[model samples]
Target: MSDKKHKTLCAYVEEELQVKDAKSFISLIQPATHFCEGCGRSVAKPEDVCKPKKLK
Candidate 1:
């Protein structure tokens, strides 16, 4: 899957799991997904803080 398509916490975790296992995992953890208020980017984990990129 392309990284751009996985724009959510559940999507990231889902990528690491089998189709059969994903449902169970989602139900178990029920992670609180967050989206960046500034750029509308989905934050997969709590530590996913937004940082400015340095231009070359």
Candidate 2:
């Protein structure tokens, strides 16, 4: 039995932000940053990396 907890990338980012270390953390994960590379706009979530399709 192991006593370890797993956290998603977003969860870790949120924790770093809460502790006022978001800038440093952001730099570390910049390659995986979820944003609009076209316009340099930051996205709200990591899942937002992919655009969703609309159904008619």
Candidate 3:
């Protein structure tokens, strides 16, 4: 691995997707198959969080 961490949902919200991009952000979180073990937030992809765990 490159040892590079994926961009987190929190960072993506604070850095990339802002209030004006709520709709876009929503799309990014839909159909969540996993959740962040560190943050406890559901996300579509494991890469979307700092620490990911399967939804099941």
lDDT of each: 0.43, 0.44, 0.77
Per-residue error (Å), model 1, residue 32: 7.6
- The alpha-carbon lDDT assigned to residue 10 of candidate 3 equals 76
Candidate 2 RMSD computed on C-alpha atoms after optimal superposition onto the true structure: 9.0
Q: How large an RMSD does model 3 have? A: 4.7
Report the Cα RMSD per candidate.
Answer: 9.6, 9.0, 4.7
Superposed by TM-score, candidate 1 places the C-alpha of residue 4 at a distance from the truth, in angstroms, of 24
Output the worst ten-in-a-row residue range by lDDT, candidate 2.
Answer: 47-56
What is the per-residue lDDT of model 2 for residues 1-56, given as tens digits with 9 covering 90 to 100?
Answer: 02166433445545664357766545534554455444333444444333422211
TM-score of 3: 0.74
lDDT of 1 by residue, 4-56 (tens): 53234344454664365666445433443554454443443543424322222
TM-scores across all candidates? 0.28, 0.26, 0.74
lDDT of 3 by residue, 1-56 (tens): 12276667878767657476777678668999889888788889888788889988
- Model 3 spans > 4 angstroms off: 1-6, 16-18
Best by TM-score: 3
Q: Of the candidates shown, which would achieve the greatest lDDT relative to the real structure? A: 3
